[model samples]
Target: MSVRLRQATLGDLPLICRLRVQRTAWLAARGSDQWTVAGKGRPIEIFAGEVGRALDAGETWVAEVDGEPAGTITVNRRSDPGLWSPWELAESVVVHFMIVDLRFAGREVGRHLLDHADRLAERADRAWVRLDAWTTNSDLHDYYRRAGFQLARIAGPGAHGPSRALFQRRVVPAHPARTAPSRYSLQGYSGGNSAM
Candidate 1:
């Protein structure tokens, strides 16, 4: 079983874009250039243009928890033309515009989303699940590294590029998979350790 990844519809635009806005604000508060208005993120016009194209290509999917939108991801078969070499584009599925709602920050929703992406890659016979992360965000880099990706290279010398740090991991969602515990099992204990 995998997290439900549904094809996004026109009606889902508000939820999707809202999550992006939330993530943009979250990153800014952390002093990260991951997605700010100063060109780390695309201009609104370009962002909407990419969304339209991805929707047309049927590459956008939303992970909904309990019938409510929780996050969005775009797994494109082609890499961004300016960021990756043509050879890299052919071998892997490129993950773009991933945004998880701030409320789901520590719930492993993003991991589950990536698991869904892994299944997509597996079915497509792709060798890897790849993404371009923001270059200066070492914290974000470490996050992906913990999720099993390896750094390939820092792709650009300047700040004005579309996610310059490339990372990849083989589509190996380890079986018995790293999953959240049954919520029922934690009923007796608060998140904090009382004994401590």
Candidate 2:
């Protein structure tokens, strides 16, 4: 149980790309049309660029299991301005590029990663943690539902295809996880690293 989060760096560029593109095949096999585009399972260079930007902004993170990188997420103060209205962006820190290793599928690694995002949102004083899920991926939507997220209204496509299934959940304590002494710490994070 050596799960923890650490800030991603330039050195982690390949790891970031790998995380986003790896489980995509699993997603496609489940009859989901999400991220099955391009040979790399996604728009790799563009995604890598986004990860680089988040790395510069200190918003990207890696979740490690027993010292191996198993997942990653990008939690930031806003969503694509064109996709979300002013209000939603104002009240939330948008979550993006969340992926757990396919190998850790049944290990609750995704849940832990999201709980960590909630903690980050709470620390940043955001009232909500929000995300735009893949529109056609019913299973992913159900997964978010099981994670306690409520479906906000779906937005029509602006530029980025139709992965606009908006979802949101409140920022609250991560019960029973002993996050108070947070087993993980995100370096360079401005918020108190108190782990709760």
Winner by lDDT: 2
Give per-candidate clash totals: 0, 0
As for candidate 2, its clashing pairs are none
Q: Give each model's whole-structure lDDT.
A: 0.68, 0.71
lDDT per residue, candidate 2, 73-173, as tens digits?
A: 88886565456777876667778888887777768778887888888766655678888887766778888989989988777757245567788899886
Residue-by-residue lDDT tens digits, candidate 1, 1-196: 2346688866777677677777777777878756665744676567767777777667778887777677888786666546667777666677878788887677677887787667666555566888888777788788788888899887765433647888888888444343443211111122200000
Error of 2 at 95 (Å): 0.4
Off by over 4 Å in 1: 1-3, 158-162, 173-196
| Candidate 1 clashing pairs, residues 3+ apart or interchain | none
The window of 10 residues in a row where model 1 has the poorest summed lDDT is 187-196
